[model samples]
Target: MFSLRTISSLWRTSKTDLIVQCQQQKQRLSSATFTVHPYKLHRIDEGPSTEVTCTRDQAINYYREMTTIRRMEAAANALYKEKAVRGFCHLYTGQEAVAVGIEDAITKKDAIITAYRAHGWTYLRGVSLVGVLAELTGRETGCARGKGGSMHLYCDRFYGGNGIVGAQIPLGAGIALAQKYTNSGEITLALCGDGAANQGQVYEAFNMSALWKLPIIFVVENNGYGMGTSAERASACPLFYTRGDYVPGIWVDGMDVLAVRQATEFLAKMCRDGQGPFVMEASTYRYFGHSVSDPGTSYRTRDEVQEVRRSRDPITMFKENIIQAELVTSDELKQIDVDIRKQVDEAQQKSRTDPELPIEHLYHDVYANMIGNDIRGITPFQRHKHQNTSKPCNITI
Candidate 1:
C-alpha cells in the first residue's frame, strides 16, 4: 500500500509534468488553421475563404486583447451601477472581436471612426485602459481631458466616438478623401450600428465613396438590435451589406475573430490598390442595453443572451479552439485572466478617484484662428476672451 504523502507527491509531480508538456507544445506551435463560417457575399464575385489561419503569437495576443476588453467593459458596468460613470455609458461587452480583429489586420496609419459604443475601438486604437476608463469617469487624465466624456475619446489618426447616429458615415468618407488627396496610402474604416442603416446620410456617404473611388470601407456592425429596437422590425431591408448596390459587400461572422481578421486583410489590400469603398456588415451582438440608462432585458430575454454566451461567445469559442489545438493550456489562460482582472481593477480605481479637469479649461480648444475676441458666454452679460493657441490652451471664440 502507498502512503498518503507519497501519493500526494506523485500527483504534484504529474501536474508539473503536464504543465511543462503544454508549454513545450505551445513553444513549438507556429500557427493553426481554423474553419469559420462562410461569409455571405453581395454583388461580389468571391468572398474570403472560410478557412482562416493565425499564428500562435497572434492567437495569444487576440485572446489577451479580447479578454481585456471584456473585463474593462465589466468594470465599466460596475462603475455605472455605482454612479461613477455617467451620461451615455455604452459598454462593449460582446462585440470585442470586431475591434481586435480589425486592428490586427490594419496599421496605425489607417484611420477608424465608430459610433458611441466605442470603448473597445478606443482602446484598440492605441488608447490605454487608463485613458479610456478615465475618460468614462471624467477624470483629468482622460484622453480628452475629461471634456469629451463617454461619447468622445480620440487618439492620433483615430477619431473618437460620435454621439449622433449615422453622423460618422459622412465623416469617415471625408477622412478617406483626405487620405486620397494627400496620397497618404491609408484607408478609413467607418462603423455604424444597424439602427443607422436607415439613415439617408449613410447611403449618401456610400454613393460619394463609390463615385470618388475613396479608399474607405463602410462597416455596419449590425448587432441584431440597436437602441433596444430589433433591426428586422426597424428596416424594410435589413440586409445592410447589400444596401450598397454598386459597392461589393461581405457579411462576416463577427463572433469569429479570425474570420474578421481575414476579411479585413483582404479589404485593406484592395483599398491600397484603389479598389475600395466596400461594405462589410459584421453580424454581431451586444450583451448590454443601448446605454447605462436602458434595461437590456426589457426587449431581449435573458435566456437568449445566455444561449449566445454558451454557444457562440467569441472569447470562449477561441479559447476552446486554441485549447483543442494544444497551443495553450487552461492554467495558462486562467493566469492571464487573473492578470487582466488586476490591471482593469487598478485602472478602474484610478479612474474613480482621479480629480476632474479644472474650470479654466471649460472653453479650451474652441478656436484655431480666433476671428473675433470677447466671445459671449451663455448670457450676454458674461464675456470671455479668445486667444488662438495650440490644442492644449484655452480659446473661447
Candidate 2:
C-alpha cells in the first residue's frame, strides 16, 4: 500500500524529470547555454584570476623576454662547455616564466631579489645582454666590474644573484624595509628555490615581514628539487607554499606564463597596498643541474626531465596557447628566434673581446680612499699646489 508521502515523492520526481527534459530541449535549440557542471564545482588552481588584459604588442614583449632568457641560458651552457665560466653557475633555462611573469606585475622602480639562479631576473629587469654575458665571462665591462661572477650578478633595480643558500630571503626583506621606510609605492619580489626553503632565515624574514607589514612577495621556485635532492627528500613540509603560519600561500602552475603573470600581478598588488608578505610556490622544473659542473641526471631520471620538457615547457605551452588564440604565428616566432640568436652571438663575441682590466682598477673600487691620498705615488697636491704631499722626497730640492 502506497502512503500519502510516497505518492507525493513519486509525483515530484515525475515533475522534476519533465522540467529537466524541457530545459534540455530548450538548450539544444538555443545558440548559447549556461549550464553548470557539478564536476566543475571542484576547486582547482585559483589566484587573482587567470585572465588578463594584454594587447598583441604586450604579448610579443613577453615572448621576447622569455626567448632572450632561453637563448642567454643556451649561450651560457655553450660557454661553460668551453670552460669559459668557472665556479658555481646556476642556469635559468627552464624557469623563465617565474621572472618574466613577476616582472610584468611590478613597476620599473620596484626591486627584485633572487637566489643563485638569477640571470633571468637581471635580464628581465633591463640589464643589457652584453653586460650580463660579459659579467659571466669575467670581463671588465660587466655590470659588477667583473668582481662578481655568475652567482653575484647585480644591477640598479635588481638586487642580486646571491650565492649563499636562501640568504637572499632576509636581504629581500631588508630591501622591502628600505622601500617601506622611504614610503616607496613599490613591491619587492624575493625569489627562492625549493632547496633554500629549508633555510631558517626564510621563516625569520617571513615572520618579521608579516609582523611589520613589509611590502614584499616571497616566491618559491619549486622545481621539484633543490640541486640534486628532491623536494620530498629535503623539505619536511614539501608543500613549500603553505609552510608557515600567518602568511597565506598559493600554489601556481608555473608552466603557464599567463597564469603566472596574473597571479603575480595579484600578489604584487596585495603587497604594494601594504597587505604584508604573500607567498607563492610556483610548481616549476629546471632543465639544467644546480651548477654547470653537474650533469643534472644523477638524481633525476632522463625520462622525467624529458617529460616536463615535452609536456609542460613554459615557453612552448605559451606559444601553443597564444597561437590557438590567434595572438601570434609560427613564422613570427621563428623570426624572434633568429633575432635572439643573432643578438646572443654578437654578445658572446663582445664578451670574448672585452678589454683586460688595468692593474690599477683592482684597487680603485676596493676601498673608499679619501681624497689627496693617491697611494700610487701621484699626489694631486704635488702637481697643482706645489706641495709635496707624497712621503717627503728624500732629496732636499
Candidate 3:
C-alpha cells in the first residue's frame, strides 16, 4: 500500500507523461492545428470540434487536390470564353475547399449527387481533368461520352450534375433509402446551392429523409448568391443548416478545408451509426458568377471578390499554414503549382482538340446492360441501335 502523498506524486507523473506522449505523437505526425469557425449544431448537444489538426500527408494531398481543382476551373473559364464549352457552364473556382475536404472525409463507395456547379466534385469523385474538360466541350473522350455535358457529368457512384435546381436532393434521398434497404453500409451526400435553398421540394426531402431515418447528408453550398440575388435576399432564413426543423444540422467554415473535412467526418459517423439524415451549410464564396456569362460583378463589387481571394482563398490559406508548420517548403509548393498548371494545361488543350463522338453513338452511355431492356423512349423505326461504347480509358485516378 502506498502513502497518499506517494500516490498523488505518481498520478501527477503519469498525467505529465500522457501529455508529453500526446505532444510527441503530434510531432511525429508532423501535424499542424488550425482554428476554424465553431460549428453551430441543431438538435444536438455536441458538434464538430473547432480545432483541426492536419497531418503532413493530408496537407500535401489536400493542397494538390485543391490546386488541381482551381487550375481546372481556370481552364474551364478560358474554354467558356473561347466558346468551346457552350450552354450553361458553372465554374467551381472559389469553392474548391468544400469539394476537396468533403471527398477526403468520405469513401469512394459513399455516394455524391450535386447541382450544376459540379466540375470540382466530378473530378474529386473520380473523373479526371480531361474527362471533365472533355465533357464540358462535349467530346467523345468525356466521362459521359459527350452525352451529358457540363450540367450532367457522372461517374460510378456519382449521380450527376443535375440541371434542375433542387432536384438532386430527393433523388439523393432515394439513394440513401436504397442504401438503407440494401444494408450496404453506404451513405449519400446531396449538395445544392444557396440559390436552390428555398425550393419547396428541398423541404419535402428534409421531411421524408428525417421521417425515414435514412443515412444521408444534405449539403447547402452557400456561396452567398443564388444567381444574382444574395443569400440574404433569397432565403428568409439564410442559416440553411438550421432550416431542417427536426433533423440535426451543422454549420461549417467551407473555406477551411480541414474544417469541412472534420465536420463531414463527424456527421458521417453519426449517420453510419444510424442517427439518420442531417443538414450542413458550407458557408463559402465563389469568385466567378453563377454561370460564366453572369460577369460576377453586377450584384457584387469587384473589390469584395478580390478581398476574399486575398484573405480566404482556400489554397493560399492551407499553403501558409503548412509552410508555417514545416510540413512543406515554399519551393515544394511552387513546384506543385507548376506541375498542376502543366497537367491542367495539357488536359485543356487535349479536350479542346479531342474528337467529338460520332453521330451513330447517340445510343451509347444510355444503359449498362441492354440485354433485354427495351428502349421505350424511342420510336419503333430505329435509326441508331443502342450499343455499348466501351473503350480503353486512360483516366487519371
Candidate 4:
C-alpha cells in the first residue's frame, strides 16, 4: 500500500534500531569485569614473582566454602562458651581461605594432616557439618567416633587434628613415603602453625622428605601470633618459606583465595611430576585466639583485628569481587550466608542430641590385630581382663 521509497525508509529504520540494540548489549556485557588481586611469591633462591586469575565458578565455590567454614567456626565458638564442647578447641575463623584454597587444588586421592586447628580442613575434605560439630561435642556420631575431639577429627584422606605441635609433619611425610612406594601419585599436605615451625621435628621431616624426594607440601600457616606470643618475638626469622634449605619454597598471600589456589596448583604439579618436596608459607591471620580459652587480645590490639576484618576478610573480599563482576548479586550472597547460619545451627542441635561414646570403647581400635591385653582399671593395682572378642568389651569404666 506504501510507496517504494517509504518501504525502504521503514526497513532502514528497523535495521538501525537493531544495530543500536546490539551495541548496547555489547556495552553491558563489557561493563561486567573481574580482576584478581596480584600476590608476590617469594621463592627460595630467586626474587619474588607475581600471578593472579580466577573464573566465575571458582569464585562462587570459594565463597560458599569459606562462608560455610566461617559459620561453622562461629557455631563451635558458641558451643564452647556454653560448655557443650570441652577440651582444647582451636577455631579457624580468619584462616578459612588457606584450607579452602589448598583443598581446591588437590584431589580425593591426596592426603592432608594438620595441627589442632583442623576443623576447617576436615569439613572441606568432605566431612559433613554434623560430623564435625558432633566430634567437637564428643558425640558418637562424630567423624572420629567421639574419641578424637576438636584436636583430633579425622576422615578418609585426612590423617587427623594432631594435638602435638609439628607432630603431624613427620606423619604426613610418612604417608607421602607410602604414596611414593605404591606409586599412587598422591601428595600429602602437612600443615603447621608458625609456633610449630620452631619444633625440631618439622626440620627433621623436611630433611627426610627432601632426601627421599617424597611428595609432601609443607604448609606453614604463619598467622602472626603463636598462642599468645607474636611471631616477631617467637622466631628469629619469621620467613617460614625460606626455612626449607634444600627444598623449593614459596610465600603467598594467604588472605587471597585465588593466590593460594594458583600457588598450590603450581606446587602440586611439581610434586606430581616427581620434582620432590615443596614448602609454602601462607601468611594469614586468625580472628580468634590460639584456642577458645585465650582472649586473643593479650598481645594484639582490638583495633588490629577489627581493621583486618574490615579490610582483608577473605569472605568479604571474595564477595565484593564476585558482586562487582556481576557474576553474583549481593542479595544472593546474603542468602548463602543465611543458609550457612541455618545449617550450622542445625548441626549444633544435632550434635547436642547425639549419643556420647560409651566407656567400653576406650580400648577398641587401639591395635591392628586384637589380642588379649590387660588394661589398668580405676585402681592401678586392679587390672581389667580384656578378652579378644568380636563384641565390644562389656566392662564399664
Candidate 3 per-residue lDDT, tens place, 90-152, comes to 989989999999999999999999999999999999898999999999999898987888999
Task: Give the backbone clash total of model 4.
Answer: 0
Q: After superposition, how far is residue 189 of candidate 3 from its true place, in Å?
A: 0.4
Question: What lDDT does the true structure give each of the candidates?
Answer: 0.89, 0.78, 0.91, 0.85
C-alpha lDDT of candidate 4 relative to the true structure: 0.85
The TM-scores, one per candidate, come to: 0.90, 0.81, 0.90, 0.86
Which one is best on lDDT? 3
Cα TM-score of candidate 4: 0.86
RMSD of candidates 1 onward, in order: 5.7, 14.6, 8.2, 5.4
lDDT of 4 by residue, 1-397 (tens): 9999999999999999999998886555443334445444444444223545556567678999999999899989999999999898999999999998899999988999999999999999889999999999999889877888899987778888899889999999999999999898889999999999999999999999989999999999999999999999999998888888787888888988877887788889889999869889998999999899999998999999999999999888878876776667788788888988899899999998989977877665654454567777789897765544333432211
Worst 10 contiguous positions by lDDT, candidate 2: 33-42
Which pairs clash in the backbone of model 3?
Answer: none
Off by over 4 Å in 2: 1-46, 367-397
**Worst ten in a row by lDDT for model 4:** 388-397
Model 1 lDDT, residue 126, Cα: 86
Model 4: how far residue 292 lies from native, Å: 0.6
Stretch of 10 with least lDDT, candidate 1 = 388-397
RMSD of 3: 8.2
